[model samples]
Target: MDGGVFANLMHGFSVALQPSVLAYAFAGCVIGTLVGMLPGLGPLAGISLLLPATFGLNPIIAIVLLAGVYYGAMYGGSTTSILMRIPGEAASVMTCIDGYAMTQRGRAGPALAIAAIGSFVAGTLSVVALMFLAPTLASFALRFGPPEYTGLLLMGLFVLAYMSGGSMLKTLAMAAVGLLLGMIGIDAMSGYTRFSYDVIELADGIGIVPVAVGLFGLSEILLTAGQPTPPAIQRPTLRQLIPSLEEIKLSVGPISRGSLIGFLIGIIPGSAHIISSFVSYGIERRMSTHPERFGKGAIEGVAGPESANNSAATGAFVPMLALGIPTGPITAVMLAAIMVHGISPGPMLITQQPDLFWGFVASMYVGNVVLLILNLPLVGLFVYLLRIPYSYLYPAILCFCILGVYSVSNSVVDVWIMLGMGAFGYVLRKTGFEPAPIALGLILSPMLELSVRQSLAMSGGSYGIFFERPIAITMFAAAGVLILLGLKPLLFKRKDWREKVGLEDQV
Candidate 1:
């Protein structure tokens, strides 16, 4: 099996390294970076838009280009998060928490550089995993039935809520709000509207773009509006752009952990790439000696989540290539492109269309290297955007963000919705409530609801199915462990408690 895998991967390189294929891959990376950095357009939108152009190209070339865009956006989105306190896309939302904090603390260069480096390492590592472990992981992923999804997603939410630095109640409340907002659109399983309230715009529910832009970017602008001295941007020195050896040392653990976490989580379909970053962030905070530094510009916060995001993006290819199941929106589009070319996806795909499968796998290597090359050289230049006067810069960013939001649906209502969300976010921040969980809830709630509904329906409304299934039982048990671990810190909060309880704290 090892020999056969190596031979197939070598064959894939032969196809991917061709001049035309490499050219398309480069173009895709460039386009993906631009799309991801831009306010409204994400990798999914970028892929959807460019998909038609690939219609005339060979299926392999088309997938290569789209694949490049998919992961390239993961790299590009971090720039917005670190530089502007805005998420370029949903996956970068967590990046904004620490990445932007680093910028305010004059560590923008280190943040950007670490994000890029971590992304490269993780992307490369995930490809290796994809190359070697696709079949086994794909089979493992198949064990996640509706009941399993219910348990896993529940555990995920519980773990994240438990790991938050703020009040768990506040986080859960925000998440509940997110879940409510997510359910606004008409039901997909049953064509019934729950919260549209006769508003046509709400019929499709709120877009994550508008909500995210409003919550992070617009709210930021509003916060800056109140500051009398808005001189926050600074030009980083060449020395500063390069991370110190100590900082690099801090990132090693996070990057390696993120890569593994992202790849494993990425196997589960439906927003797994986005979810991987959040999961990584929680894990990092839990593991860090200085858990308190998490939202305070900790390099680990940036490194871990960014690495996880890119790797998860890479990891998403596993199921599609091995099992014909699209793991996320981007892979779904890529699969559509492949099927349009009359290529069937599934278990036999590797045997029947080894060229497509292996070549697609190999192209990831080329794409990750290309993205790293594209990103590193531009890090210093991106940091310079902060040097611009906040007076001029804020309005420009605001316009781009608004335009990005509006462009998604061509609806002015979304712009208004974004502004409203921004104001709400500002209020939340003032009230010491975190808005990040809200975004996660909005994104994951629908999937969770669908899984729970399916699981219940299958068991005729018996909740015991979640406990009866072995995988589901494992997930619930994991959630239970996370809960107890989360309680450990609280139970030993006294000054002398750590010595007694063995709870490690970063000095």
Candidate 2:
């Protein structure tokens, strides 16, 4: 590494090692693991719920805590998937296929051990990659103009919709709805209110916090209320937690490949963790000497997907921190959190807020160590949490959600927005519509509109400016390809489209 990069990292460690920052990191890790173990509450909900509580803290400390929660949840998700056959998050869905099978065969210990170890390896490696790549990407992004940004945002939305494992048309429609909702407040250029209906609260755009908490947190409680409880789990002894030497030898290849695949895929805009896990599972199955062993009790299956999921989670931060563009719903929430702290995340973020940027990066390394310790020795405690009845759990979660949303601006209006959005989200869930694209669209819409308007103003209202810039042209071309690829199934009426997209028979 360069001396400057090394120097910044050393300074970051100095900040992250402070007593208060360590406490925050520890607290975030614990809360994240608990939330990840709970069904219907993933990183998105976990981060959104805690966002209001961070308003009183320093921006660096707040982000460090939130970032810890983000990856800590990734670790916890595997625990539920293995012990109870319940995926705590969508990215852990592949883990259920093999992780539970290993548990059934009395190999739960090795599976859990391999998962923690692989995640540690991937998480640490990805953080190193982030430290180097984010700075380089930010420098490159400084060259971008309004037209380039317009094309990039447009492509980002399209890529997210394309990769989202649902109906393309539905996802596109949801993005459109989000864009319209984003335009509700006063126009930035004309200083005129568009859709506020003269409500004073509507003078500013809808708050992202309430909308996120409502859609992902409150709505989840309502949706999961009717689901059957998870099955009982048997805890493994400490002796059983250690994997055999042969199993360790078998896992190294899959874990390494999974890390590389996940990190690369995560740099793209979409649900990369979910996609990466599926990809890792497929690669392991194909490369296995005895493919028939998969879905029956394969250690490689458990190791590969878990590692990919964690690595991809780390990779998702690259775009958000460097380019100020969120790749998925979770990163969008993080973007909002950073903005709420009066810090704009973009090319200048590293130079202007090196302490915040590098300190947050250093915290990830510390957080990974914390997660390994938590997952290895305390795995049994998390399993016990799953036994709690949903009847009692849902009510508590609802109360927390209400309080968190209400606390944002201390306004009942925000609470109502949350509840209204919760009902809407629940309805959308029942109708097979994914809420992720809508969230991404809502977050990116203002930036999209501003970039387009700015480009138009600079080009004398000409539509050809997008094509005139090489970078913009490249981004638009990529967007066109993604849109076409997303529509291929409908156009060709392919029966195996889901399989091709890695969504076939997924739980």
Candidate 3:
């Protein structure tokens, strides 16, 4: 290890291992596990629901708590997926196929054990990668000026919109709306508010906290409430927690491949944890000698996807910490929390705030170990948590969301804003729109606007600056390519669309 990197990491462990920090880290993990095992609440909601409470916390500690929730939820999701055919979060959805199949075949123990172990391995490795990669990236990013930043942020948004599942057009539409909404507050360079009407609440702009909690958290609650409650869970005994040597041997390759895949994909901007999980599952299924064993309690199914999701979840930190970009909803909320605590995130953050940077990194390692320890021996306890009915749980969560958002600004207006956004979110959900692009758009809008305006100002009101810089041109070109690639199917789909329309009409 380089002296500089090693020194920063040591300082990080020193802060992270302190008794108070450790206690809060433990609490965050426990809270994450509790919320995560619930059918609907994912890390995004979990972080959003708890954000307002961090108003009084130290920046590093607040991040330690919230960051713990992020990855802890990743680990927690597999429990219900394996036991009850319920996915604790979006990433866990892939696990439900073979995980539930294993439960039916009375091999849930092996599945659960492999998932926990794989998550630990991947989580640890990814954090180490993050520790190394982020600093190097930040060093490289030091050369970025406003025009370069403008192009990069633009690239990020387009790449995110294109990679988000479903119609790229729909995702871009949501992103544009989100960016417009994010522009409601103030023009940083011009000192003028762009979209806020005469309303008092809109003056400082929409709070990301209220919007996030409402859009992802409350909307999910409303959607789940509209459906019938899930069936009762079937509990598995702890005595069967042991995985056979054969099972462990079978899992090794998937875990290794999944970890690498997840880490690489996680660095990209969009649905990475979920994407990595699905991709790993596909790869594992294809690589299997006994391909037919898949979807029928194949251990590789659980091992690969679970590891990939965790690794990807950890890999997402790279961009956020290094370049001040959010790759997904989880990082969006984390960015919100850090910014709310009055810390600016960017390439300079590593040098400007090494403690916060490395401390949070070290804390992730601690949180990973903490989750692994808690998840295994306490499997029975988590299974009991799954048995708790959504009937009773949703109401309490609804109340919590209300209280959390209200606490953000101590304003009833924020609460109303939250409810309004929640309704809008439900509409989006029902209509097949992904909320992630919107979340990214909303969080990143101000930065995007700032960069563009700054670039324009530097160019003396000319648009040519974006094209003049080699880096800026490359970024814009990359975004353009992604857009073209996304449109490629549509460019050739006239006959296919007609065939589908004809087939649907016959149906």
Where's the lowest-lDDT run of ten residues in candidate 2?
A: 496-505
Q: Choose the strongest candidate by lDDT.
A: 2
Q: lDDT, candidate 3, residue 175?
A: 86
Q: Write the per-residue lDDT of candidate 1 for residues 1-507, one digit (tens) a residue.
A: 234778888999999999999999999998888767755456765775676677789998999999999899899999878877767677888888889899998889899889999999999999999888776654576667789778866775665566444566677788789878989988989999878889899899876666766776677667665345433454555567799899999999999999999998776554666767877887888788887888889999899989999988978788778766655446766886788799987666776777787888888899989988777776555545434555665677677666666765678988998889989999998889877677667766777899999999999999999999898999999988967766666787642322332223321
Which regions of candidate 2 deviate over 4 angstroms?
286-289, 495-497, 501-503
Residue 317, model 2: lDDT of 93
Provide TM-scores for the models: 0.68, 0.94, 0.92
Residue 266 C-alpha lDDT in model 3: 90
Tens digits of per-residue lDDT for model 2, 209-245 = 6787788777778877868876678787778899999
Superpose all Cα atoms of candidate 2 onto the true structure and report the RMSD in Å to 1 decimal: 2.2
lDDT of 2: 0.85
Error of 3 at 398 (Å): 1.1
TM-score of 1: 0.68
- Which portions of model 1 show Cα errors greater than 4 Å? 1-118, 225-361, 377-387, 487-507
Top model by TM-score, which number?
2
Model 3 per-residue lDDT at 160: 69
Q: Name model 3 segments beyond 4 Å from true.
A: 289-292, 493-507
Score residue 490 of candidate 1 by CA lDDT.
70
